[model samples]
Target: MSKYWNEEIECMSREDMKKLQSERLVTQVKHVYENVPYYKKLMDEKGVTPDDINGIEDLHKLPFLTKADLREAYPYGLLAKPLSDCVRIQSTSGTTGKRVVAFYTQNDIDIWENCCARAIVAAGGTKDDVCQVCYGYGLFTGGPGLNGGSHKVGCLTLPMSSGNTERQIQFMMDLKSTILCCTPSYAAYIGESLKEMGYKPEDNKLKAGIFGAEPWTEEMRREIEKSLGIKAYDIYGLTETSGPGVSFECEEQTGMHINEDHFIAEIIDPKTGEVLPEGSKGELVFTSITKEAFPLLRYRTRDICVLTREKCSCGRTLVKMSKPMGRSDDMMIIRGVNVFPSQIETVLIEQGYSPNYLIEVDRVNNTDTLDISVEMNAEQFSDTIKDIQKKEAELVAAIKTMLGINPKVHLVSPKSIARSEGKAVRVIDKRKLH
Candidate 1:
């Protein structure tokens, strides 16, 4: 079996995958009932037993778990094993003081590592390739999860743990790292750094990138690939789902192939709570059937996506989901059309402006209008202020062409926008909704 974005498991027959999911679901239900008291109580409160969750198709009968539920349980509330049994624990960044934590038994960690190895292999990675992971470690799951996975794949792994771009580049050059892992924005920063250091893309060691933890557009992907000389692939996951590696991109590069044997994915309308069929746009839900330390049932991911069971060019039988266009929580009802800030980023990048931009929404008279502030690159500074004004007009015109809405464009100096090392706050809404 070739190690690439599409795995041998992806090509499994539909009947086989469903049967496997059914067996795993039953096993996971029993595992949770016997280990975690919190889940047992939840199941009991609903007058349901582990046997009630017999098959993957019956998932809707069970209670849905949310991030808020995980927060309430905190560190040990939902753990399926005793503290000693769990070899590792990871927490959300907790930027707002309330963090969702997850635990991993030694066996759980091994499964996670294998999934990551499969992801690497799917993206054309081999044991000889050096893996440089730039995700943060400690309570955050990105670093350690991928770190373990890289090693499992027999690659020399670099746990860079985000930031320190210069040092990251230095180590990359020294080690000749072929696989890069980090947020897409950070990858963009690294690409800019390479250019500033007078390095040629062909001479650099990077081959492919596994990017996630932020919402990005296909336009951004083309920009990254063009600048870095690497095919940037999307990885979908969270701490609740055992970090990244839940799904991965294959050589087809169309969409991410979900790991059906481990996690059952579903799409549903957040308002009506009805399951959306494949090809329908809605929020993504995941039920972890193989996770041991913290198995989540019907966990609402809040990511907006479309699921498709269509066969891919790759030989994998795994289901594919579109790249998350935005989060349900992050969707803004502007005027009439739904607007995601990444939409603006896509437009700005396409217009040859800096990707660093912001959206300020406020009420004008009675209607809401959005003011988009974009940073001008150094290349545009040599011109007069009048030229800058004309440039802003051109940007506004371009955004309209792309998003089908007109927004006020404000020109700012280079480096005016906040540098986002973590989650980027793109919108500031001041309008009052009735």
Candidate 2:
């Protein structure tokens, strides 16, 4: 039998799940329309009202909320509860223009933690397991979200925030941590560090890892798993949607399952805003049906991927989202061809190159130039210049086949590329600078 934090909810029939979602969505729509003036104004302008949305079926009628809307609303415009009622707040990293702040009441926190607990349980975590959470803490949601979920699972929780890699490994070895939680890039770096420390995968006690907070390729996943000798599961969420527990990967490893009981998901054409049929690739949208302090109705997530109801071996009835193809904002147009960083990473890993690389896009004489600097494997370094050139040529050929664009591949020495303790900065688009 498959194990789950909430078996009934996870395995609920489609009919029952839809009914539950319908009821919660109606209540949530009414709550937002009544409490949030900013959303109320949006509804008024769109000629939509809470009564118009009787259930999830009417969700598309609601005005969609975008990052631009959140920025315009700023701190308090979208808040559905009073400050006194809210117990906590989490903000986005603000690497971009403005940081998005989301509030959570005690009840909201409870529901969010419950969603996270389902993720932990789905990743083979239990009260007996030691969960070491290393996704940054404080204003960022990743650390706190997973930390609370670990507690909910009754695991021996280690609230070790991100960074201090050497210490992260020490705790993992000393406590025999069974579940590792952090960004996929950090996990990859940790795997590299373990080898440097003369520790084999078997020397550590980690059985599974829940990695997220950034996009990672399946090739990168396999690399981390082989290095750490553990299955690396992907978790997905954003601060707007109440952190990292909105969805999680089950043992199937095919895709991440959305917590449909708490949130309703949809796919829409990014440009046309038309909802697509199942299995169609488009922008992933979400509606929080159970949040109290901050409720977002039909929020555009900008992640490009497909949703599938196809039978999964894990037996979770929740809809599964393919690993995101790319964020709409992150997809670049190079010489009239669309390119995603993930596409480049996929080619690199397939060519036996390290995931560490830099993509530089620039306009020269009105023509877009794509140049990638890839870190060479120390073991594969050839002494002869001709051999090195041959290696670069081979990579260029492989990338061309994958991306349909010719890129200049420059091979640098191993470990020359700076390692990222957080989300790796892989792209430097000089075209934007011009």
What lDDT score is found at residue 255 in candidate 2?
95
What are the TM-scores, per candidate, against the unseen true structure? 0.91, 0.97
lDDT of 1 by residue, 231-318 (tens): 9988877788888888888888888888888899999998887998889999899999999888998889988898888878877778
Model 2 Cα lDDT, one tens digit per residue, 316-383: 99999999987766688898899999999999999898899999999999899999999998787978
Maximum-TM-score candidate: 2
lDDT of 2 at 59: 87
State residue 359's C-alpha deviation in candidate 1, in Å: 3.3
Alpha-carbon RMSD of each model: 2.6, 1.4
- Weakest 10 consecutive residues of candidate 1 by summed lDDT: 1-10
Separately for all candidates shown, the number of backbone clashes (residues 3 or more apart, or on different chains) is 11, 0
TM-score of model 1 (CA atoms):
0.91
Candidate 1: C-alpha RMSD to true structure equals 2.6
